[model samples]
Target: MKNVTRRSALGMVVAAGGATFLAACGAQPQATSGNASESASGSASASASVSKSVRSDYSGVAVLEGYTSKPSDYQPATRTEPSKNAPVPVKPAVANENSVEGLYQSIAFFGAAMEYYMRTGKTEPLRESALDNSELKSILEPEKGTLGDGMQQGKIWMQDPSVTITMLSAQPERDGDAYNWDIRLTTDTGEFIASKDRVEEASSDDDRKTEVERTLHGVYENGAWKLTGMRTSSSSSSSASASASDS
Candidate 1:
């Protein structure tokens, strides 16, 4: 996986944005709509449907659907933050789920949930959905810990980090013991908003955008598939740049 640090907001824009946002506070999304990028308006606010905006019960694994918000309605608190527009992440029914689509569901939902986790300061969303592994865990600690801590402390919240994760294949390529799928991620580093009225935008200063290509690796553990690694094939953002062979 590309370096997933707080420094490169563009690497996380899909997780950042995949949102419902006012076109003014951030760049407008050009991603095609699908289950991967579906969003509702003002989902974080009191206007969203109860079934759609409810918090996670820490039970099932499902995708976190996104909600839209305008810049004028942005708030310093979690109550009406646009990040709230993204509902809790949940996975699909894992029973007898041993197909490529099942893994796609897991990857998509996990990434979406992480976006919500890093943005909302909620831990359970990522907790219940992620399957742990020593190597992947260590590599993601910086992102998991840094963003997780910041959101929990209310120190930082990505304003419109737009992230889009796409599964490139309907099948997997086996490389010895691992199952790998070619995936691509595109991000827009939205304005970074801090609780004390601090705000910064990484990509806001430039027009250049980059697409990252990564190989999503997994292993069938026990009776289920677990995400084991993300190796970068290509990285566009400086923060995400690293060795091609490194995960």
Candidate 2:
């Protein structure tokens, strides 16, 4: 019955970012508009393979306000515990000229989706529970078996116990029919849960507190802004830093 908040759950997704759950391809130069399907040969040569790299899903959570014509018409939404197959509700808000507000809401929506996918092993509910567009669809289509298998084999689920965000900003740009954003945020990884469904035993805590900086790439479509790609600027935890040096 414990309620999970966006900031808390966000780190769980960030932690999972490195697992390479998505495709094996690398990032290609995104089209200004139109076809986004990229071949493996198009992957960026300088960094990690796009498919193998863990991109923060935060920047791409769709904010519903972007879909409306009047920015002022948006209303704030209430936070609720996510349910299986149920969509998360986003209260609308106008963003600054740079689209800061929209980015925040989208991050929250992504948090909701991540929590649901972790609990239920499916992203199907995201289509209803949140705003959708072509980019979002493409991202969700490939991970069905992988996500389901993790849930079945590990039975280990994550919940953001506590977390906070500071120094957040989102810069926006236009590309063809879509918009791209560079979002940066820092979070305190609070105590998170790793629970086994079958056991009644009390859960244990894990530390994920880390400083992260990243550029989030997104595309706008279907009246919503959807995440398309991301690159971390830096990700480091104090504890982890010490452990590395000691080794």
Candidate 3:
């Protein structure tokens, strides 16, 4: 199930870092307004913040409060930065148990949690889950830093986005005292499940979803399964109407 060639879909999407940025601030000081007016008289880009980079001192930066008519009527949204108040993603209770089925559920939970953070700009859930210097943290922490930068610059994150993580079927081998699932995971939304009539998809979305099948090295530790490390097995885009794998 391991492939050295592929990186994570989550990483790919986040690394793109093409979040939307607002041109003008909702409010700026009177002194700053004069400078903004001066800049506006010169060039469009000079009077507004366009890039995804933040400055140490915003006062010096000319931010024209967009006023089409009455300045009072055009109240631009006051989203200075990400609200950072997204509710923490709830982890599945079954993930805490040290068992085979529990391991499967735990891996699924991690997939869901990571996607949630990326989609909604929710940091708490990923922060809580990616821990212990395991492989998952290494893969995800860099993405976290990218998101942080976007937030600081007041850039809107994840527009019309789609992401999916498929836990592949593979055999687990023992690693020391802990078991190691040398993670060959991901494929179509639905994968083979000979044991049952159906499998609970880890997650699926219709918003331009990125199809990511990455091999995750899973380990059971402290009574839960954790993603230790990973390599990409495959990466592609999922059709909006693509049906789950029935085979």
Best by TM-score: 1
Error of 3 at 183 (Å): 6.2
- The whole-model lDDT of each prediction reads 0.41, 0.32, 0.31
lDDT-better candidate, 1 vs 3: 1
Candidate 3: lDDT of 132? 37
Candidate 1 structure quality by residue, lDDT tens digits, 1-247? 2223333334333222211111111111111123322222232222422123123232232233332322343332332243544444444443113444445555665566545554555555445433344423322333323433345554556555444566665456777766687666554445444434444434444432335656667654444456644433254443342212212
Kindly list the per-residue Cα lDDT of model 2 for residues 1-247, writing each as its tens digit. Answer: 1233323333333433311122111100000111112211212222222222122443333333322211332222112222122232332322111133444445444444443344334554345322334434433553333322333343333332211223233334556644554443333222332333221122333333334444445443333345544333245421121100100
Best by lDDT: 1
Off by over 4 Å in 3: 1-88, 130-148, 151-154, 160-162, 170-209, 231-247
Q: lDDT-based ranking, best first?
A: 1, 2, 3
TM-score of each: 0.56, 0.39, 0.43
What's model 2's TM-score?
Answer: 0.39
Q: Write the per-residue lDDT of candidate 3 for residues 178-236, one digit (tens) a residue.
A: 54543322222111111112212223443223333334455544444565443332434
Error (Å) of candidate 1 at residue 30 is 22
